[model samples]
Target: MPKLIEMMKPWQWMLYIFFWALFVTSIDRHDLATWPQFFVKFLSRIVQYTLSIIPSLYLIDYLRPIFKRDNPINVSMKILLLFAITSAVSATLVMLVMINTGWLVYERKAFVLNVLFNIVITVGFTLVFMLYFIRRYRELIALKQSFEHKLTAQNDLIKARIAPHFFFNTVNSLVSLIESNPPKAADLLQHVSALFRATFDGAREISFEEEVELCEHYLAIESSRLGDKLVVNWNLPDDDVMYDMVITALTLQSVLEKMLLNVVEMTTETIFIDITIEWHQHRVTITVTVQLPSKTLMIVHDLRRHVNFYIQAERLRAYFDQSADIQSDVTNEQIVTVINYPLYDVSI
Candidate 1:
């Protein structure tokens, strides 16, 4: 009964109550002589209808699992049959009460007609309500699938942009490494090859731990090239908040690579890059802060534009159903990039 009430919309409940009122009024209109009698009959009918319909609805709910195993046509037939049987029992009980209370005649013909009318009304209401609810459910499902498809397309575009951007930078780093340290260049190639293979495995989402590992590898390759000029700091929480949570693939790595590349381009001196990960209120936040020289203050705008373009923050928002938030702030001393997304635990 609670499930039935929850499943019904406000207007649906109103319509259901209205139908019962109309049914009762139609059957007892001849008895309504005065205002007092009308009120009494209406109130009595409301109680009677409630008593009858609640059990019928409860029976339908109880039988839903069994009905679902059958085909649609069979399910409809079984529901109609159930409604017919329950309505017959309810009408017989109402007739007994009406006759005993001197509200109805004791003729066989009148009693038969009353039971038939009750069956018709109850079955008709059940069929109409079921059809309307099923149609609306299908419509909602279709809309959800359509929205998901659009999000997938947008994520694919973002993935395409990230892969080439990271590849180009890694290749450039390899070039520099080959000139200075041939052995490290070969090792970087092996790492880059493994990263490339993982990227093409066609995974739309990845675990937070896996994403952080990818970022670390990318930073390692870059660190080899830049040496002492680049300083990387990681501050990851020791808790299990991020253990099962998943986000779009390449999300963390793309932001980290983009920010570091921008910092390297804007400064020739040593730069400190701080990466912090924390969990708050079912959300995972990644903050990357890079200490920038005062002379490169004007480069913030260019960095913002590049990060927004390559990271596709808006696309991430859509992919995560608007649960992702990405923002950038630049000061004279540092550039801060913050990415927050709901911790979607697949295990749950």
Candidate 2:
């Protein structure tokens, strides 16, 4: 009994008390002019109603699981039938008790009328409870579906960040480096291994500095392949701030990887890339500016269509519970991508 009561939600308790109060206050006791008479009649009605409701409440609770497993039509019909039978029995018993105790007039017409009123009130209460349960069930289902969708989006974002294309390109670059510069190739392989290990480390978030270090390793591998052609200029926040702030793992790395792939594939000549990360007012903003040749404008457009920028944007939004304004701006000279999201700490 204690466990069952503990399982009842606050709303359920409130509803029960509300109906009890409604039923008690609704009893017609105006004919009892004296205060003592009114008090006795009211107390009598309260006891009668409370005793009558216990069996109905227990029956309804016992049958709830069965009703929930059936169709809505079946459930509604069963509940109505249960209430009708219980109300008829309870009203008959109450009418008999009232007449025997001289509380109600011993008249056939009056007894029938009282019974009918009781049935109506009981059925109304049952219908309200049923509606509340149904609405609560639907809300629970919607919340579950929403939670599932968020999990799916997070998984997709993580998968996109650690995509096969990046690894394939890194492997091809590693092969080339192995033949030309074995020592550099060894270092690149170690970075690649560490990056893959980090992805499977079961951590959903990492410090800002750790993410930047991962990006630097990625850039190092890319630089080995495109040596003189790739020029990267990094502007990062001060060490005190960078080491404290936390973000979704691989968020910046994913953006950088996409930008690098676009630039490396389109431009053959030397291209400059500037990465700027700033922190202000509890926000982190990463801006990547890539200098592209005039001839590669068409290629950049085609690459943009294939990238999963929207997925990354959604991931950030889910993590921060706010808009992660991820935008790309293209011009005749360069392509700039900006990502802005709320800064969280390790405790979060």
Candidate 3:
């Protein structure tokens, strides 16, 4: 149902009901004042019910097509046509019933008054419906704009994070091998160059599956540096749900990189990062959960504040109108981020 129709005043429904009652009463107003009158009223009511219910059913079925545009002129014309057809059909049924049973009554002034009232009622309902629709339409536009703005902000934030992340990981790799072996440090320098090239090569948006590959590449670089200290787990379906769906340019890559940065900065134990994806009827769910360092939680209080992962979540919501949530337990031993996004259908 259109928002306008759903918000109609009780008086509007009463007006429709009154039209049906008036048709029944008017058709049986004279002549045989007994069973014939009752029969005329009953028969008129039957016609009224048919005309009212069938059109409403058809209208409901075809409502999506009708609400394609929000122009007042077009909407008003459509509403008027619908009401006029229904009113005319009801009037005709009443007139036919009156003539059949020899109870016909016609006063020109009263007939004109009745029609004018019906027009007034129809116009009132149409005006209210349009008012509500226009309000909702404007709201949706504002929402879309707000979302676009957030996406732009998030893109900048991701770009800023990229440079620092790249430098940190590269420096960390070299720093780890500084005193141990000159030959190993030389190899680390090569890995750093390749990692930087891979990380900052392009700013193109990729599909979900592609993002996963990029994430794995980043993790691979980190693993080579961290050795057995880092652990990564993936739980993804074996379908094109990931490959066929588009995500923000390097969105998953940035997130995975961010998680790794936090892990490397804080944790030395076997840090486990789990990534999972699921597809439902209307949405795709992505979950990222990681083990928290023992002392870092005490130092930073809330590590989410330090990394600004919440900003990424807000950015995702702005673009998708889906929900993104992060939760940490009271013990602060783990942090979990879950994102739900509407499935983009590109098959057509």
Task: Score every model by TM-score.
Answer: 0.62, 0.54, 0.55
Residue runs of model 3 more than 4 Å from their true location after superposition: 1-124, 167-207, 220-229, 238-254, 265-270, 280-285, 292-308, 320-323, 330-333, 340-348
How badly does each model clash, as a count of residue pairs?
0, 0, 0
Model 1 CA deviation exceeding 4 Å by range: 1-149, 163-165, 175-186, 295-297, 309-311, 344-348
Superposition error at 82 for model 3 (Å): 5.5
lDDT for 5 (candidate 2): 29
Instruction: Sort the predicted structures by TM-score, highest score first.
Output: 1, 3, 2
Could you tell me which 10 consecutive residues in candidate 3 have the lowest summed lDDT?
Answer: 322-331
Q: Write the per-residue lDDT of candidate 3 for residues 1-348, one digit (tens) a residue.
A: 344334446566546556755654565455447876666665655556456535653574466565565676775677667766676566556665665677656676655665555445445655665576668878878877776777666666666777775767667777777877768778667656654564454444457776676676667657767777788899997766565776555666666776677666566677888888887775777777877766544344555565555665665555565554433332367657666667656663
Per-residue lDDT of model 1, residues 225-267, tens digit only? 6778788899987757667666767777777767776777556
Q: Candidate 3's C-alpha lDDT?
A: 0.63
Which TM-score value belongs to model 2?
0.54
Q: What lDDT score is found at residue 281 in candidate 3?
A: 73
Q: What C-alpha RMSD separates each model from the true structure? A: 6.4, 12.0, 8.1
